[model samples]
Target: MNWQDEAMRYEPLKAQDLYDFATAEQKQEAVEAYNRAVNKLRSGNGDVAGIALRQLAAQYPDFAEAGLLSVCCQMLWGDRRGALQILQRFSQAGYLTEDESFKTERYLAAVSSEPARETEDPGAVVVMDGENLRRDTVKPPRLLRRASADSGVEVASASEQEAFLREHNLNLKKHHYVASRSSNLLIKWLVTLLIILLLIALLLVVFLLLPQGGKTGAAATASPGLLNWSGLRLWRPVNLFQA
Candidate 1:
């Protein structure tokens, strides 16, 4: 049967029910493990805490506290779907119920009240043992300062948070695109200029060589005396007959 069906088959177990089933040594171990996980979570080590909690829940399936705290860690890590699945699993295991206090926890309640959307804001604060444990909010770009969580101040709404992230991403992409296009255009212009300069240099070389060729042709035509000196001279026979 599916988890929902399975969950419906058995009545939910409370903390006392879980304790009743555990051995004395297992109970002591569970309590110690739960405390360590809580300490890790309070110290902002949610990743380690989450793993520990999951292991604790697995080792002692009846430990309701471990399961509930695991949900908290999932929410803290921005894993809403994961958190919900853990709750479902716990429900199926009889450690959680529809009327359990886990549902009323601030993180779950906030996410549950809203429709699932890309823009939904997972809350920045976690409630544990009737205490508000504030998480560090991400700092947005300078342009989105109005929506940022400054000095523990919460954002006005989820919509503003979504807008801030969207605008920041758009601006980053736009900057990269503009920079790339500009570099391409600059390269094209430089190449075109270099080609133009090369052509001009070629024309200048051709022009410079043309004058030297013309001078050589003129010198060859004007030096006919040199060719005549190397051959037979002109004769003066008519002058001898007159004498």
Candidate 2:
């Protein structure tokens, strides 16, 4: 099918059910679909995205990326069992990349443990997912008195805000580091491929630009010598010994 074809056309898990799985090109198509689904999630249509991701992962069993995103979508929707089911499926297939595997492990760990109750609502707090539920954090000193905030807004104390910022920053740094490491690997391979292609092209050009062998030498050797005499009417070959 063309790239524009609907992702839902294939039956759920059909591709993954195949023993050989997808070819490299087919896998690329799946990757594109996965990306589209991810964008859909950002647009707030997480259901469509999640379904597409599930089908994609199941269709191409080895596509670890699709599986990971599918799990993430389920997790976002708070479907613990469903998310774990998908995770367990591909995880058993052994296609999950290192990062995906690590996340899966964390998801399982968090699921097995008690759910942290502190982060039930959005707030200016540092509570990580499924962490710091029961524990109380000390309130930091406030610089100014609390302002009369809007009714709808839930303004946290200064300490809670600070804690949120700190946690957010740490999480951002950690994620950025991990993402950069993976991206650098892809960049390295791409650059190496480009260099190899450039070298090949240069060699081809050099070979083409080089002069063919022996033509000039043969023509020079076949020509009359400079000492050959020329009359007013016509040129003539020289007989040096007779002269």
Candidate 3:
């Protein structure tokens, strides 16, 4: 049978049947069936694939492949928290690959670092605390405003500090600036591919039109004087008749 027919034949195999298959031939058949389902999902029937994966997971809870497939479905469905929890559980169960663990840790760290709620920008507000009025920008307020000028401390160009606070909704946090080297290799590679495709398309067009172009060129280049000497007798008779 053809490959398309072969692929189409095993669409009915379930996850339980695959797990129970002990023989090499049976295992291969099961793998092929799962691959067919995965391909179908990738081709835009993700919801159907997801239901299949969920069924697979329910049938085989300890199956690593089923767990990973369920996680993938959750991510595609936009359930980030559900995916994260699954990843965490997989990591704890030692079922996650090294790359999966790394990605999970990175996601968790980034989520934990975000502020609980937005803070108001303290724009030169010198609130009094007890007997002291302090410049409110500093996290702990280094000097009390009572000992400084009325507008607040005589701090030079606190705009940078103020701007950082306003932007991040944080008070007096030190900022670090670092320039990263630009690596535009992907963009360059894409542009090169585009140029190659355009050149290929141009060559295809030229190849398609070559016969017509050759016919036109032959007609344009051909002249009465350019004909073979054997044809001179035919032309000579015509000229004699005209005379």
Candidate 4:
């Protein structure tokens, strides 16, 4: 049978079923690993977080949360095909339900609508015959409930989550370029304004000094012998007495 036919033969595995089969230590290890991956994601290291999450999901194939988070990381890192593949796996496993927030996740909206084979990654196509899908259904586990509360990852809506991821993925270099360019323009304008003010002050000083110098030169020309007071004043006082 083809992989698709094989995948169709088995019932989908639920999160609770996988949880039931896991040992306490295994559950503990999975939670710790998930926490570490979440920390990496929170610190804006999506690439590292993606790798960690993928590894965690691979190590614990039944950990639906790990697979889901890894899908988010893949989307954030621009790996649509990878994200789609994970989503397909979970969908086949019945991890994705009608009410799951992933149904409305914008990243998957386009991918879900199109044919999986059209993706550049051939592996993006679902492989249902894998051992990962060969599991029995069971009751839900407590770890799923407690992990949601303690993991520190916000259980916001899919849109909000996508917004959060986009916020982190913003092109910082573009922002820096715009900011630096704006600052340079502002500095140029300030310098130009300062140069204009200085020129105006210099012109005012020249104009004031020029008028004062002109008045001084005119007075000197009007009374060329003004410095020689002895030429007339002393003789006029003595002549008044003798006459």
Candidate 5:
């Protein structure tokens, strides 16, 4: 059942709702239920409120207040000792304290004198009482690290743990921004190196494909005076021997 919603809907089931003549016990029980509901809300546990609501409505439908709050405690639970104590007390109580109709002394005397008859259903009879109920609020705790059952890990006690939670509460958990900047720098340097190597490779290919030739602009044409020594007998090839 949606107990948390019900608890909030009828937040303070007034003392008058019980029987018109409100007693201190009735007032206190309403206050107690309201406070515990608030505690369960803060602790983020709806199950506790549900259990309490079921028991309270069953025991004292008129009182609309006192109840038990029990939880398995394996799930996401917080530290709420006051709420737990209220549940424990309800679990072990005798009948409803405010219910003047229930005489506990007479009931116990009858039980002791005679045992249950044959075919009598064997179920626990819940006896509700809230005389010792008190409301207490729980303060929020820090990040709690859970250990793996398979791994070799030692669970730390409350005394062993430090008062302040370390880096777990820090706003910036990692330096991802810095790492990204460094990666960008490495990529830029790699591209620059590749460009330089490509340019060097192009220059080498051009040099290798160039035509090889002997040195030029040094052999001058023979001067006319040097050739004139043989100019006096200059003649056609056919008449050069006779001349």
Candidate 6:
């Protein structure tokens, strides 16, 4: 019989059943089944692993380790969203912790591992392909020279990385108003031109309407002036200009 059938059959058959049943061997068989499922998952046989995981979860709901295994199986089976939902539900049920339910063996292993060692040759230089050196990597000794130059820049110093703002101005962060200034400048020019055009049009109108020196000289000369009116005696008209 299968692991589940064996477990169910032998569960109630205790006491004398312990002696009569294959309980110890059955538990070992169950572990073997679990290991087989885990191996399938590791080997990318996700569908088979997922079935095994589901069966294990159904048989062992209280097993936290099995819960973790089931979730991983779900993830490998391309049911990432399903796995996340299950984790969330388990967390809400107070059966999972912040890190415990979400932790992946891969992530935990990586976190617990040591840093990688650099095996690069110190004498050989590796230059990156680019038009500018600012954005490219240099191999070995050349890199050391560029780094050790009197410029006080260490090649490894992240804070003083030469290429950090190579194409951008650092001060630009503090001058957001520069764009506004440019826009205002353009508007000012437009307004000034409009005012100048208006002034020119007004001048043109005045010039067009006013009589020129010789254009209507005859008519202007014939027109009576205030002095001419003042000089007129009104005694003969009973003092018409007395005021």
lDDT of 5 by residue, 1-243 (tens): 232333343343445444422345644454455455446544554433433433343334333234322222201122234234333333344334543223223323332344333432212111111212112222222222234435432333442222211111211111111122234566999999999999999998877665331121112113222222332423223443564
Which candidate comes out best when scored by lDDT? 2
Task: Arrange candidates by lDDT, descending.
Answer: 2, 1, 4, 3, 6, 5
Sort the candidates on TM-score, descending order: 2, 4, 1, 3, 6, 5
Q: Candidate 4 on 1-243: residue-level lDDT in tens?
A: 121222122222333334432455555555655665565555654454555566566555546666666665555434567767666655545434443345425335655664544344212111112112111122110011112323532223444333433343421111111122234566999999999999999999999899899898668656634442534422222343554
Report the C-alpha displacement of residue 92, candidate 3, in angstroms: 0.6
How much is the lDDT of residue 186 in candidate 5? 68
Q: Which residue segments of model 5 deviate by more than 4 Å? A: 1-22, 64-243
* Per-prediction TM-score: 0.35, 0.36, 0.30, 0.36, 0.22, 0.27
lDDT tens digits by residue: candidate 1, 131-235: 222333431111122223344344344444334323322111111111222345669999999999999999999999999999986675565342323434443
RMSD for all candidates, in order, please: 22.4, 17.2, 21.9, 20.9, 30.4, 28.0
lDDT of 1 at 104: 31
Worst 10 residues of 1 by lDDT: 170-179
Which parts of model 4 have CA positions greater than 4 angstroms off? 1-18, 95-110, 113-243
TM-score (C-alpha, index-matched) for candidate 1: 0.35
Tens digits of lDDT, candidate 3, 134-243 = 33532211112333344534432455334422332322122221111112344678899999999999999999999999887566447442443543422222343554
Q: Which of 2 and 4 is the better model by lDDT?
A: 2
Off by over 4 Å in 3: 1-33, 95-243
Kindly give the stretch of ten consecutive residues in candidate 5 with the minimal lDDT sum: 164-173
lDDT of 4: 0.46
Candidate 6, clashing residue pairs?
125-139, 126-139
lDDT of 6 at 32: 50
Prediction 3 global C-alpha lDDT? 0.44
Better of 2 and 5 by TM-score: 2
Candidate 3 matches the true fold with a TM-score of 0.30
